[model samples]
Target: MKNLLIGTAVLAMTAGAALAQDVVRLGTEGAYPPYNFLDDNGEVAGFERFLGDELCKRAELTCEWVTNDWDSIIPNLVSGNYDAIIAGMSITPEREEVVAFTQNYTPPSPSSYVGTSDGIDPTTAVIAAQTGTIRAAHVSTMEGATLVEFPSPDETVAAVMGGEADLTLADKDFLIPAVEESGGALVFVGDDIPLGGGIGMAFRQSDPELRDKFDAAVQSMKDDGTLNEMILEHLGANSPTF
Candidate 1:
């Protein structure tokens, strides 16, 4: 009878494992590239794709990619629309109150500055950031400059390009593409300060099991060189670090 009971328990555990292997949906902004963005053909590509693939591999699970607006991704994850979020979000104390984080995937801090003219030094000019974003808080504390808050990064970038705001601040990865796309109308000008010290997978705070699993998978990838390889592939060899 004891052996039969053990057999039943084993079967139940196997069934549970099988149930856990169902389609795990991942959320990304699909707006930021080299991290998570849509290609010309509208297919998902970039660091987020590579990282998500590694996580699914580590967890031995199948996944479906889902595009979401930047602000809605976390709320949707909390609402159970997806299993996890990998949208180049930084781990912060306030965010920790609402969601849990996996291991640090990319290098923690990566900041950059953009100005209308190549001759304008960002540190000495007035800066703008999207309101209600981490970047807004980051730029608001500059010692000798003023921070103009906007509704979006695009607006901040546009302000600089259109000669409204003197500069704009954002994660270097995001800033680079904007600067390049501006065709020298806007130039990057910052002191290469380390901004985000810990980038990680975000999960609802209630989902500790899922968080732990994702965290373990991130650590496994880090141990196996997959994370760094993806970073190098996107950010290049000369990328700044903290």
Candidate 2:
């Protein structure tokens, strides 16, 4: 899960302003795998792709996928570039003030620290996190730790690998594969830190009807056990379910 305060420049639209549009655009950051990413053919693919498609079908809405950079994903949604944000965005009070969020699609996930070795103390180490993420905010508040931010998640991992930072904090799911493939170069350090409420679809505050539709669709998936199955399939067996 991740969080960042909304900027002041965004102005909310009136109710129903975007809901009347014919095609609903689902925005996502195509870089985060398992959640959402680009396939070899450059199409959006992964857990969210499947989930969003099913949601559209269940809601009886014609939808299209749109990829946006992670940092600007929310702003673009607010700017009407898309109708909804299905990026692995965490539910946080700071963000809720700007955009309306549907019921969460995924439960709270733990954030972990990945480093070159096991003995390093994350509390005082130079920690790297993607800019605008909850992990970065958490690191900044640690009394002795130094927070280094990068524009992308991949660069956060690279910082630790290159010795630019003592550790990188990110979603446990996102780091697990990287650590596994590192061949012992990277290991999890410190306790797993839980952050944010959960993952959800975000819509403009004015688009309550559209938000409600997706919320019902998400609830339908949960009620039928399909969401849980998809969670286990894409997020590993240990992943939390509805």
Candidate 3:
């Protein structure tokens, strides 16, 4: 009888430990606002963060958040540093070769930016954003438009406001804080800008089960208004129409 009781207790303890283990390690560029960003309290807060949290709960698994530089996110995921990526990373056919993608949470929107300068004439000066962003890609192809490539969106905004570049192109989502942080030195060109592709989570090519679980969770969030509430919290009164 004592042996039976001991065996049951051991099994219970083992089961509890297994249940407590985190099932997924989600990586993100915690600097991207409205998508994923760190709050004043040093907690990761954003639309994507909430979605990731919910997905873990829905799948009955533990989820741990990890920070990774945006440029290296995919490589780290591929190397098993994390089980999945929840960055505001866009899903593209190019990336599909290396990793599978969950259904898009943030659909693609046109990349936009604000241009500013004190003394320099916009007609004569070069305006640009960082290299490799869709904005830089588009700006570089314009006739006579010298697109200055900076290291990051923040740098590009500095260049433009400091008269280094006439302007910078960034995702509309990013442009909001950049302008606010710039102390009114910059302004969006117009509200009529057309946007581009959607953003989705990245996973290992061999992990379709995880991807499916995430996709279903996202759909549930979408249907239940959880995703929208998170969007409103991060984006202010004028939340993006998801």
Q: Name the candidate that leads on TM-score.
A: 2
User: Judged by TM-score relative to the true structure, which candidate is superior, 2 or 3?
Assistant: 2
TM values, all candidates: 0.81, 0.94, 0.78
Residues 102-169, candidate 3, lDDT per residue (tens digit)?
87776566676577634443334587675545566667667766777875667777787677877676
Clashes of each: 3, 0, 6
Candidate 1 Cα misplacement greater than 4 A, ranges:
1-21, 118-126, 143-152, 240-242
Q: By TM-score, highest first, what's the ranking?
A: 2, 1, 3
Q: Candidate 2, residues 14-87: lDDT per residue as tens digits?
A: 57666688899999998887789899999999999999999999999999999998888877877778999998
Clashing pairs in 1: 108-196, 108-197, 109-196
In terms of lDDT, the best-performing candidate is 2
Model 1 accuracy (lDDT, Cα): 0.73
- Where model 2 places Cα greater than 4 Å from the true spot, the runs are 1-13
C-alpha lDDT score of every prediction, in listed order: 0.73, 0.89, 0.70
Q: Model 2: number of clashes?
A: 0
